[model samples]
Target chain A: MTGRLRALAIVLGLAALLIATVLADAARRRAARDAEASHRLLVRVIRLPDLALSSSSRWLRHPSQAEPGAALADLPAGLDVDPAGALIGPPRAVLEAGRSR
Target chain B: MRRQLALLDYAVGALGRRAGKSAALGAGLAFVVALFGAALLLTDAIRAEHERLVEEMPDLTVQRLVAGRPALIAESFADELRGLPAVRAVEPRVWGYYFFAALEANVTIVGTERADPALDAALAHGRLPREGAEVAIGEDLADHLGLRVGDAMGIPLDGDIVFSPVVGTFGGGSAIRSADLVVARPAHARRLLDVEEGWATDLAVDLTTEDEARVITRRITERLPGARVLERRLLRRTYELTFDARGGLLAFLLVPALAAFLLLAWERLSGLGDAERREIGILKAIGWATADVLAARVYESLVLSLTGAAVGIALAYAYVFWLGAPGLWGALLGWSNLRPALDLAPALDPLQALSLLGAVVVPFVAVGVVPAWRAATLDPDRAMRGAE
Candidate 1:
């Protein structure tokens, strides 16, 4: 290819690539946000209360069988998930009265 | 200096002769520069905004951590805080997430019955919400919800809905205030959330002085176990660290791509094929001084790299300030959905840009010199014969 023509091609390619990268990134971010909304909608709003109620009744029927936190036994509340002692906000958040929070 | 300038002119002509390679390399490098520089500057601007907001934030906020989760605190905590010497006022703030089923997104609902001096300072278009069941929302929220001043807003309640009168809509100096914010009286918020008379989401403590934040926080935790105390300074630090960590992650992700570009650039500039080496040899055979040869090569590198840096810096400005950085801003802020149309103030200094340019220019010039010099020093007769 001629030098000027090759240069034009490279410029066009670079512009296209950058534009594509930006659009794709934006789309991916939007999809991610939508996914998060759906997750929150499903878990927090739709099914959580029903699940809690169902679990509450199950334990009530079998009163003899109970955990230390009896109400918690029915509360699946991440029974399938591992609970970690990770605080959500600032690391400097007070952990104790005189310590970090 | 005159001689160097002449060689630089010659270098420009020479680069023009190889316009295809030069344009390709320069443009690609510019793209890389734009990506990295934009990320740095955007991160800086957002960090600055966070710092500004933190300055206005209350000194200390105390939250209840019940069963390893945040829950409501009793109003009785306010009396406990009033005993502290440094404490000026303890406000039991009633604020929580309200899932706007219509919008299908969460909007923060804040309620303060008292005359908030802070809100008054920022009160631009209208007054703060005064009476019970009165709400002063953000202008954007007002527009989105299709509500006007004096219009009543119907909030969904248990079996029956409660309507609150829209007293005012805030604008100007409200960048930190989200468009989805719904500010109301504490009584209305309590009624909306079904919170009992003595319950609150958290307590906001206004200290007599800034220095007393930590001491008062310590006292609060001592008085109340499982209470999380957040200081504005600490929150500011957290924001700085979070942005820094995100920038670090971005840099890490881009390293491979950056390295690949550098490698390709090095190979192109330093790796001379047979014809190019012969041309260098002919220049040497024709009695060109070693310094002159080196100057020409260095000038060529400078032209391309500097152009790249300049283009990069310009693009970065447009991205962060004008177009709002499309996908990148969301990544930096971690708020995917709620990024309204924001015109970010660029916090980039000329010195910072120059420093970045210096860092970029050095590598290009340094990398090109060695190979060009090596070719220049070749034995004249052998070089002409293509006998490297």
Candidate 2:
């Protein structure tokens, strides 16, 4: 009777330990995946550089000018500019460069 | 001594016959535990999905306000933003809210330039809105309106005027909040909103450093007052809080169920009375030690717990995964059909299973210990006299 009881105890203890291990492992994996997904998202958000307006005189809003002062500098690479802003930069730059020539 | 061995042999045979039935009961209980554990896992998965979507959203979204009313941020502002030293990509997004009185539905029209990649990835059907008049509805909106790709639904603009041609549909992650989005080109949105030179919204300034997010936000606030700049982490937390109230209610519901399980296990183990007590005494009198008596009872209790817990956890997983946490949002908030945004993996791996086993087995073992110890230490002479 004692030997039978001892055998039962060993079996039950091992089974209980197995169940606990499975639950904990599942939880740990879920947490790790969540952390990885969050990190990926943060990386995407932080990759872009800050954009600044050009400081060229041609595009400056001069108070004395007849029209609202426009920045005549070239639009930065890979940027899309509205049609109105596109016309001023090339001509203004040419005029300024010619003065130096 | 031989007579005592025969009784022990008979008891062992009886246990063998009963073992099958006990195993079946344990299996049923294990299924329930597995279901419960699965539901818990599914909840975690849905939250993770929400976090992923929130993280993908722009770091700082800038919208223009005029006289406390929203105005377009000039198209040139995108260029202006692009030129800033701290700015990375200044993507202009055009959007406006539309109210459909007949359907009592409110929808937002979002427009993006063909050059923008973010808008492109969100598309679910048809090509991007190429012309100034075409639009793409969100999947939920499409379903509700019974509109499909190449289907035309008139969009009402200001002054009771309406625009025609719903060209496509798109799908997004958040079912709770993003159900009514309609996508179009920036020009189309601008026309609908009557804004000629600017955007309804602009996602500006991707900073290089984490610390710089605060600095850049301050600069933008100083430069363009009244604009809101939200960091990605803050936005993710905001979305998480949307489910916080629901989670509290779920916790409350689980507490009673857990208590009931513990009580049921305790009663089942404790119900053995004098006949069983005598049987235990008879075995102990023949030289069985306290450890042996305790071991058998503990073993029996552990088996019952493992079965019950496994079944419960499995049932919970099915409820969460297949049926989608039914009666959850409705019970918490009067909203039915709140589809969780993320896919949850609800499997009881080795560790979780072990934890659950411990939760059940430990208490029952402790309860059985005292009774087993008393039976084991009983003197054979006294026990026999008392039995007679």
Candidate 3:
């Protein structure tokens, strides 16, 4: 094959390899689905919100578990904003919007 | 097919001539793709984990509101729900966060409701607590407090200290679920959390059928005027929204970077150098159709983009799944002192990857072809002269 054809082949091959890696990773995860059973039991035993975002304030750490009425009671610490903080409006807007119910 | 291959060959050769520019474009594109791909994948994985964790949550959680803040509810409320139709059980739970001044972090203390074999199976180091004074703590908490099984730790509540021996520690797949958790007997938990007698944190309502959850939620609200009934589905929805919003915010913050990438790609493709102009002129003079010239340019763009995207995606996958997403994890999830293991289950959707590729390649190819089209229509002689 010419140099140009060789280059094309290499590019295509690289792409295929990457996609195969992803698929293989997915398969590994599927095989480990039983691992989640323990997590389910843990959840039932102690029904705290997810620990993924617990590194911040109590309200921000467990937004789903936090009181909804106090959603905008305090300002989030700088750079400690969790996803729940973003989904809930900012404090000023939340106050201005008032109660919806 | 032969004609297309010939065009592709020419495009590859041309790219080789401008190797430096091609490499720069490819690297920039790869970085942008990696950022977006990793964010998308991490968000989806975390969401899936949340769903799995919440799957076993109670059908409805009832909390009392005292001036818009969560306060302890009377255990009598559980009795009110127990008599409702299709209601299976109403469990009054005792749980709250205890601020440990030693680490300046709050640890969750959950009171176990019953003696179950499942709790024993979930422990990584030892068995569940058999007594009120014995407790099970999370792995992170255990590590921080330097406590092992049979070791006692002091938790201060209201100027007094309550000591509980660590009977077990939670780890492995359940690490994310119990990273800052402490499981204790109901009496010990209430003492550690300073809860008053006859009051509980919340009521977990289980139903015979999940279909009755909405109706039960309504009845609970009507019967208990100041109660906040949180359904499992609503909590799941909140988790889903939180993940989506987190990922979306990260992507939004990178908008300027994406725009810069687009500008760079457009400049590289549209602002062809003298050599490129002359090459196109020669091709046109040699009876290469305008369509042929454009096809060759499109091919060049495709080759670079496809290669860049593939490399970026692979790097992203390794960065998140293998490397544990060092810097990006804290950024996507909250940067907390006590964080879950985040051993997120890998979930790569083919459609999501395809959409990312399309988001990058479609605009790139379009940018490349427009400039090539403009240059292709030039007079052959003027083009050979390297005219703009």
Candidate 4:
């Protein structure tokens, strides 16, 4: 009976340890993946203004003098640009002037 | 009455003999209780240390925001902030997060004036990082990364890579906050992060009293329209939330310690045979009240619980301080050379001790009370005959 009890205790202890280990690994993996995604998002967002500034030349020479549809299309995935928004007003003005030409 | 007292004395003495089953039970109970106490003490000590570290941070912080995003305040803002009546010291700092390849971890890089007294006080080793590429890392980070003074670390910064020489290390009480912090010159952090003439972070004004934080914060908010000003206490509370988020993992790690304790308690209780039950019944049958039997059992449980708690606390201290439980440090703390921070001073106060005692005793009593009461209320004749 004592031997059996000892064996049972050992098994229970091992099971508990295994469960804890698996949970910790899962949490670590989840955190790592989330961190990677957040890092990628930040990098993508910060690069947007630079992309907009560089793409202005192509639209400026067009005779229509309207914001080029391709300029808006070049925006990164999941980013929406509203021409009427105040935050992007200055940049939109440049685009509008190019479209008017 | 005299015979009963003698029987009690005999029962106590029987616990001392190596051949006696009572002795084995007593020893096992004592061992388990000791471990329990140690665990409580160690956990409390770690908690107390964390609290102390949070208290030591600046009372108010004024940081600059760029386009609603956080950016380093310019050094010029320090001059503007210093002139304010409510402001104490405008400690302009440059700090950013960077990854270190050798450690395979991200570290916070802090840049401050080396001559500044407040910043200098935090240094634990050789000297503050003087040159552009020189760095001073946190004590916990250095230990984990196996870094020493003069070791060149490759710092991955935004738009640039820099090899910074580690000149020193310093300890902070918090495990989460203190880990992997590198201190450097303001120019270094600015150049690395590719921010021209801008500080990355600002710790505004150390106030005379904590009460002045809100007023000062409001003043700063009014002054710098886009800047974020936070009271130090509020910032600490935010850090505390982060700490608590990780606490679930720490609590999970303690399951083994708790399970061992419950099993020991169960084993001790299960060992009280029918013979002992009949003896207890006989006492009740003669003249002993239910309250008296209950009181004695409670006293016994109290003895075991208190002993266990005390021992556990001591063992935990030894594990953290003297002997150092290397296994626990690695598994739980994620760092091996973690010494108990100076801020951590866990006292054996009556309230804390009592709480530990209550935690152990109340649960055990809840489990044992009904069985003990049933044993005490059994008919003495039937108990003696070993009948159900």
Maximum-lDDT candidate:
3
CA lDDT scores, all candidates in order: 0.62, 0.50, 0.78, 0.50
Off by over 4 Å in 1: A1-101, B114-125, B171-176, B271-275, B330-336, B349-355
- Candidate 3 lDDT, A1-101, residue by residue in tens: 67888978987898889878887987787568655566666776776546535633566555556464444233212122343643343343333342212
- For every prediction, compared with the true complex, DockQ reads 0.03, 0.03, 0.27, 0.02
Q: Which pairs of residues collide in model 1?
A: A93-A100, A93-A101, A94-A100, A94-A101, A95-A100, A95-A101
Write down the TM-score of model 4's second chain: 0.74
- Ranked by lDDT from best down, the candidates are 3, 1, 2, 4
Residues A19-58, model 2: lDDT tens digits? 5665575577567655543223222322211110111221
Lowest-sum lDDT 10-residue window in model 3 chain B: B330-339
Expressed as tens digits, the lDDT of each residue in B265-291 for candidate 1 is 888877777777777788888888888
Q: Evaluate model 1: give its TM-score.
A: 0.73
Give the CA lDDT, 0 to 100, for residue B116 in model 3.
86
Q: If you superpose only chain B onto the true chain B, what TM-score does each candidate give?
A: 0.88, 0.73, 0.96, 0.74
* Residues B1-388 of candidate 4: C-alpha lDDT, one tens digit per residue: 6544443343333222223543343355445544544454445444433443344445665666666555657778778777767666767656554434444344555565554443444455656677767877767777776788878766545435568888866554222334455666778877665567744466546666788788777777887887766555664454345334344344555557656766765766755677667767777778777766665565444434444444444455555544444565444332212222323233334574566556555776554455667677777667666656
lDDT of 3 by residue, B133-163 (tens): 8999888888888999989987765566678
Across all candidates, the chain A TM-score values are 0.37, 0.36, 0.53, 0.36
